[model samples]
Target: MALASIPTKQYIEQREEGYWIKGSRVSLDSVVYSFLEGETPEVIAQNFPLLSLEQVYGAITFYLANREFVNTYLQNGEAEFGQLQKDCQQRSPQLYQLLMAGQARLSQAS
Candidate 1:
């Protein structure tokens, strides 16, 4: 008898925004970050209800297998977001201050 093989599932898709779970709006970054923060696959699934346990595991496997690429992607995204934040602060100081206050309130509430 020969061992059976199955096709690998593709859990992430690259979009203009970033890598997301295929067929879902959830981002691979969300899953990877939670996993890095010591979350279990089950917990990650709970955090992103859009994803299943299998998808979470698959995403984690993909991240692990392409760690270098994913790390670079994450770093680039962080830099882009930081630049966007700076731009927003410069473009609309009042609006940025209001948003910061709201964020601070939310943090305090948490």
Candidate 2:
């Protein structure tokens, strides 16, 4: 049997910042992370609720064409998130402990 080809979608115009993800009103960096997490264009569109399917596909295409840039963005986002988590933990020990325990359980299960 022959494999089916995915349909090509039109590119969405980006905002003046040039870092806008086609599908989401959010920054390109955010969309890159979402895509890296294995989210589908449809899922991204649903999450944003403001972007069209064409925009989502366009964002994916843009990311694919600029893998290096997007990878850097993802790395920076991870670092930022880690810092935020550390700050939260420092500010709230009890909450941090609870969250840490939950994460430990989740890691063990996985």
Candidate 3:
């Protein structure tokens, strides 16, 4: 008897904004970050209800398979986010301070 072969699905795709899970709007970075932060695949799936357990496993597998490329991409994204935050703070210091204060208040309340 021959074992049946199952075709693989493309779990990740690169869009103009960034890498996202195929067929969903969730970003691969979000899943990867949560995984790196020690969240189990089961927890990650629960956190992202849009993604199935299989998809979470597949995304993690993709990250492991292309670790180098994904790491570079994530680093670049972090740099970009940092630069953007700096620009925003510089562009409107008062507004930035206000937003920061509001965030602090929310954190304290939580």
Maximum-lDDT candidate: 3
Sorted on TM-score, best first, the list reads 1, 3, 2
Report the C-alpha lDDT of model 1 over 1-110, residue by residue, as the tens digit: 99899887788898996899999999889999999999999988998998899999999999999999999999999999999999999999999999999999999999
Question: Where is model 3 poorest over a 10-residue stretch in terms of lDDT?
Answer: 8-17
Superposed on all Cα atoms, the candidates' RMSDs to the truth, in angstroms, are: 1.3, 8.0, 1.5
Q: Which residue pairs does candidate 1 place in steric collision?
A: none
RMSD in angstroms between candidate 2 and the native structure over all alpha carbons: 8.0
Q: Rate the local accuracy (lDDT) of all candidates.
A: 0.94, 0.76, 0.95
The TM-score obtained by model 2 is 0.59
All candidates in order of lDDT, best leading: 3, 1, 2
For TM-score, candidate 1 versus 3, the one ahead is 1
Q: List runs of model 3 lying over 4 Å from the truth.
A: 1-5
Judging by TM-score against the true structure, name the best candidate.
1
Backbone clashes in each candidate structure, one number apiece?
A: 0, 0, 0
